[model samples]
Target: MIIRTQVSFSVTGTHFTPSKVPAPFSDSHDPGVIGTVGRFRGAPVPYGSAGFEAPEKEMAKIAWIYERVSPYKSAMRDAGAEHCTLSVTYTYDSQCALSFSQEELKMIVDLDCYFHVDCQTAT
Candidate 1:
C-alpha cells in the first residue's frame, strides 16, 4: 500500500513576495518563475485570484498550500537526499515564532488553521 504522512500546524506571521505574471493569457503561465512574476529566484509569490494582494493575503495562501500538500513532504524526507525541508509545522502556533498552544490555534491573523497527519514517523 502507498504510505502517506500528514502533519498540521498553525501560522501567525509570514513573509510573502509578489511576482509578475508571465504569459498573461498563455496556457504556460508560471508565477513561481523567478523574474517572470517577481524578481529574484527561490522566492514564492501570491497566486490565484488574490495574486496582486498584500503580504498578509499571500501568507494566507502559503498556509493553504501547505495544508494541501501532505505525505509527499515527509515521504521524500524518509528517502534521504539533499533536499530542502521544514518540520516547523505542529511546533509553531504562529508563523513568526515557534510556539504552539494546546488549544486550537489560528495559522494566520484572523485565518483559521487546520492540519492532519496520516503517517507517524515519530511520537
Candidate 2:
C-alpha cells in the first residue's frame, strides 16, 4: 500500500531527524541529481540534471551524519550519542520501498525494516 507519507527518525539517538521534503505535484525525475542552470562552454544547462561543479546528492542525511561522526570510532553510533544531537530530515514521494531478491532478501529486510544495528562499524 503505497501512499504519500512523512516519516521521521532519530539517527542513533543523535540530534538529527531525517524529515521528508515533500515533492510538488508537478515534480520531475532523478530527485538526487541536483544541479544549477547555467551556460557550459556555449550550451545551456538544466538544473535537475548533473552540473559540472557539484555531484548528485544521494542519501543526504547519511552524508551529513557521516560528516559529523567521521572522526569517532563508531562514527555513526557515537555521533548519535557522543555530543548534542542534530536534527536532519528527508522527504520522499513514497514512504517505503520493497525489493524482491531471494538471495539477499533477508539482509535487505533486516536492514530496512528490522533496524538491525549489529552491522560493521566504521573503520
- Candidate 2 TM-score over all chains jointly: 0.19
Residue 36 local lDDT, model 1: 40
TM-score of each: 0.20, 0.19
lDDT of 1 by residue, 1-123 (tens): 212222323221122111122212112212343334435435643221111111222434335434433323333223221222222222222232233443214433222223332323333
| lDDT accuracy of residue 28 in candidate 2 | 25
lDDT of 2 at 92: 33
lDDT scores of the candidates, listed in order: 0.28, 0.27
The global Cα lDDT (0 to 1) of model 1 is 0.28
Error of 1 at 98 (Å): 16
Q: Show the lowest summed lDDT stretch of 10 residues, model 1.
A: 10-19
